[model samples]
Target: MSVDGGHRRITNRLFYWMAGGCGFATGVVGAAFHLAVDRLLQWPHWLADRLGTGPLTIAAGAGVAALAITLAYLLTRYIAPETAGSGVPEVEGAMEGVREVRWRRVLPVKFVGGVLSLSAGLVGGREGPTIHIGASIGAALAEWLRLDKLDFHALLAAGAAAGLASAFNAPLAAVLFVIEETRRQFRYTFRSYVAVIVASAASAFGMELVGGTAPQFRIDTDALPLVMLPLFMVLGAALGVLGLAFNKTLLMALDWRAKAFARVPILYAVIVGAAIGALAFVMPMSVSGGERLIAEMPVADLPLKMLALIAVVRFVGTMASYPVGVPAGIFSPMLTLATTVGLIFGLLVEMALERSSFPVPPLTGAAFAVAAMGGLFSSTIRAPLVGVVLAVELTGAFELILPLMVTCVTAHVVAQVLGGRPIYEVLFERSERLAGRMPSVRSAVTSSPVGIDDPPRSETR
Candidate 1:
């Protein structure tokens, strides 16, 4: 027994070391992916500028986007269908011992496919793919290290936390996200909790070293009047409705694609990619994951009509691109859509204030943008703590925590009352029903005996 204990201790140490390494690597790879995509997207702009012929440049740009998206979908369809959509569900399911983690397939396909899909001006975020990538790394290393099934799940969560931290430089929020958002799958043990913290810290540090430390969004407003709490709640309720609409629309789109277009995903991809490509050519801000759009919101100060138009385009783009089954995330896109709604709401409030005699601090666009982001995310994702923490952390606006909590929780409750299930839960259900019927569709989960207190599975061990 003494000898066995000694070996167990040494094995645990090695697992920790490997898990830490995976976290560091997640940061590095995530940063590199960001840089690479930025540079890759720049080439089209560079070519267009040099070409000096708008038609020629536009055609060239569209062609490249079409080709890149075509290749990305092909890779996903033929190689690994698991690399589709927001991968948070995939990681969550893996933790529950439901789906297989083929890092060998996931790592390369996600890297290459994510680059192509994102660079092609799709409405998606890189962080979701990065999470999948990070979990794959941990799973691969755990297999190489011969860790038990229990440790495998722990390290996987640790890696996912690291990936999210690397993406937004929000280590604490990332940890909370793993613990809160994936609470059903993730069982917190002392070793697992420590691993998650260590990994998140390492990922944040390493990513900052590579990508520089900058808040994802800069907000000038520090606080809101207490009188605005009711308004914030109203905003949350609006966002809750928006969230329900967004989820219903996206799922409907997915169903339409599955029923009507699954037979020819490639052709469908080309048509969708070309439309997005054309939009990219005409209005670059209307396409892609929407970081640029978010950054421009405060400075551009566009009119309500223009903002509404842009918001509609963005919403359509998100709905169209997401259901096509490529490697991408809806988080950033959803945030973009929600921010637009907030802007519209703020504009209406500002108009109301202008007409009224009440004197209060005028709400800034930045404030509404940030608040609505969390509110809609809370409603759709059904992870209010993650949404609040993420907003506070990413914006570095701890002052808004009170308003955020109010907004996020309000939205969450409204969505619950409206009977709109979380988007991921809906996706998981779709996956199960479609798995056998559709060759391209795959389930994120299956019934597994592995639970929080389950002993190590003999097969996995």
Candidate 2:
């Protein structure tokens, strides 16, 4: 090989190493964050058991949640405002050169604030904070090593993939998420994306070592019959409508919060946190991220009315929780809400089938619940492939892939027909307008065409 070729080969290898190392570290950190949040989450239930059912027990729960959420909100408000909410939009903006990562402030604030807010029984997912934290870790590494702008960008994407992989224990889904969800922002190149793949694998490895190899949600069922495909499509269309409403309501709540609590935002946090915490006493399923509820759905014998009530309560709680200026995400809550809606549909179908004397399995509702996860995700995120893969990975429900695909595709198409935009993209634009800042005119990295054989320049940031 020519000298230039040899140098390029070595350079690619080094870049891969850096990306993998960053991913591994992110996985380690992400696992610890999950474990810590899980442990902290038990506190409220433990307290409830010890205190018994009474106004004092409720008051204690409310006070603790209020204090935790308030502290978390203050950290983001004073230390790093960009760490507010899920931080997904911020990371996307940073990728487009429109926002700064501010790793020094972001890393610590996001970690502690996320723990406090999520463990306070706020209805939000941990994945968003983990994604932001992963990107920040990549940023820190790139800055310390003084890599080129292109490498820095690549590392950020890799870190994001690693974060999701660790969060869901789904490496392939993580890679797809970067490729599909962040496609607009991510700089696509063979080397860069391969680095992403490597990082995702390493992150998944680290996550498994620390968090065990079990799927995030464990529910299994037989393969869905092709005859039932139309039902899944209908389910998808329903979820599309739900997704549109979800985005609209969330944005409306955010706007209202901005106008009503502009000066005293912390008060909003106190109210939301206290309300949710107290409600946890009577309705624990409606207050949390809903992972436990989702896992238990296969066996839980909840009535249809109770399911509807839980869904409504969770929908309102999620809308209230996210706008409290605390670190939170909608992914987990979205999954839960979709599951409830799907199970409702499934139960209704079973009732109709029974009236007609058709046999229905006990686990059929669970099948629909699993498929709805991908459907709603597809509609909300506008990334059908990622949604399908994520659901399959999270549940290990390979048999449901056919239904998942039908649901995701129909959901995507229906959401588009309804003129609903991808939630993250809308959020990014709104953030830019709110901050009164224009996106930077200069692109971060320019390189050869996506699949070409060229290395990025060595210019330092």
Candidate 3:
């Protein structure tokens, strides 16, 4: 018994070391992929400036964008279908043992495909894809090294936390995100928790080394007015409704595309790509994933009418792109929409309160926008704690915790009243259906009886 205990201790230490190393590597690679996509997206603007605008120039730009998006979509459909649309669901499904993590194919496909789709001005973000891909990489490495099933799961979660940390530079939030968002199926343990924290910290450090540290969004510190709380509650309610509609529309669109273009994913991709390209030419702001738009909101000072129009267009574009099976995320686009709505609401409030000579603080709306971001996500996904932590971490706005809680809780309550289920739960159910139709791999790993008090198998040693 003494000898056995000593051996177990040694094994545990080794597992921790491996998990840390894999987490660090995942962080570095995921950060690199994000930076590369950013640079690639800027290339088109540089090219347009160099070549004088004419029919030929316009046609060339459109053709390039279309081809790039189509190719990206095709790769996602053919090579790594699971990498499609904000891979959070995929990760959640994998955690539940309802989906397989084919890291070998998924990592490369998601990295390259995500870059292409975003560069071509598709409405999406890299956060979801990065997390999914990073987790797969961890899982693959663990399997290759013949790690135990528990350690494999821990490392996978660590990699996922690292990816989000690297992408958003939100270390604490990444850890909280994994814990809160994936609470149901994630085999949580002390070792896994520590692994997630270590990975997130390393990823944040890596991002700072490469790009320098800056919060994802900058906002002035201002308390939300008491009067505005009611309005915010109203906004939260509206977002709850919008969240439900968005999910339904997105799933329907994907289902329709699958049926209409059965076995012809390539052709369907081309059509979606062309539509995005055309939208890019016409409503440039609405074409992309909305990152640039969000960054420029303060400077633009868009009027209510224009903001309303943009919000509508963005909603449609996001729905179309996401359901078409593209490898992208909805986080950035949702932020964009929230910002638009918040700004419009602020502008109207400013007009009504014209009696005050003080400059209408733009930060008020920005704060609400930030909070609404989490609120919508919480409402749709039913992960309030994750939403609050994610928003705080991504934005680096610790002061807005109260507002975030308020908004998220309000939105969640309203969504629940509307009878909406969590988005990931729905996806997991879908994955279970698929899993049931496939062969099981239970023979590959030792069958340890899991008990109520048994630590999740994914924990390190």
- Against the true structure, whose lDDT is highest? 2
CA displacement after TM-score superposition, residue 407 of candidate 1 (Å): 0.4
Instruction: Tell me how far candidate 1 lies from the true structure as C-alpha RMSD in angstroms.
Output: 5.9
Instruction: Report lDDT per candidate.
Output: 0.80, 0.83, 0.72
TM-score of every prediction relative to native: 0.91, 0.92, 0.86
Indicate whether candidate 1 or candidate 2 has the larger lDDT: 2
Residue-by-residue lDDT tens digits, candidate 3, 326-431:
7788777877787677677667767766767645654666676677777888787776777788777666667778877877888878887777767666655555
Tens-digit per-residue lDDT, 1-461, candidate 2:
11332222237888889889988988888888888788888877799789888999999999998999999999999998988888678877877777788999989999999999989889988887888888998999878777766677888999988887877788999898887777667888888989999999999887767873322587766775677789999999998998999999999999999999989878998998898779778678888798888888767868899889988998998888888877777788998888888889888888888898667765788899899989999999888888899888888889888899999999988888888888988888778878896644434344423221122244433
Q: Give the TM-score of candidate 2.
A: 0.92
What lDDT does candidate 2 reach at residue 370? 90
Clashing pairs in 1: none
Instruction: Give the per-residue lDDT of model 1 (tens digit) for 1-461.
Output: 11232222235566567777888988888888887777777756676778864777777777788889999999988998999987788887788676789899998998899989998888988777888888998988777766666788888999998888876777888888787677667767777888888888888777777873422665555577788779889999998888999999999999888778767768878887777776776887788888766656856778999889988989999999998788898888988888788888888887887789966464456677788889999999888888898887766677788888989999988988887777876787678667763313333342222222122255368
Task: Give the Cα-based TM-score of candidate 3 against the true structure.
Answer: 0.86
Winning candidate number (TM-score): 2
lDDT of 2: 0.83
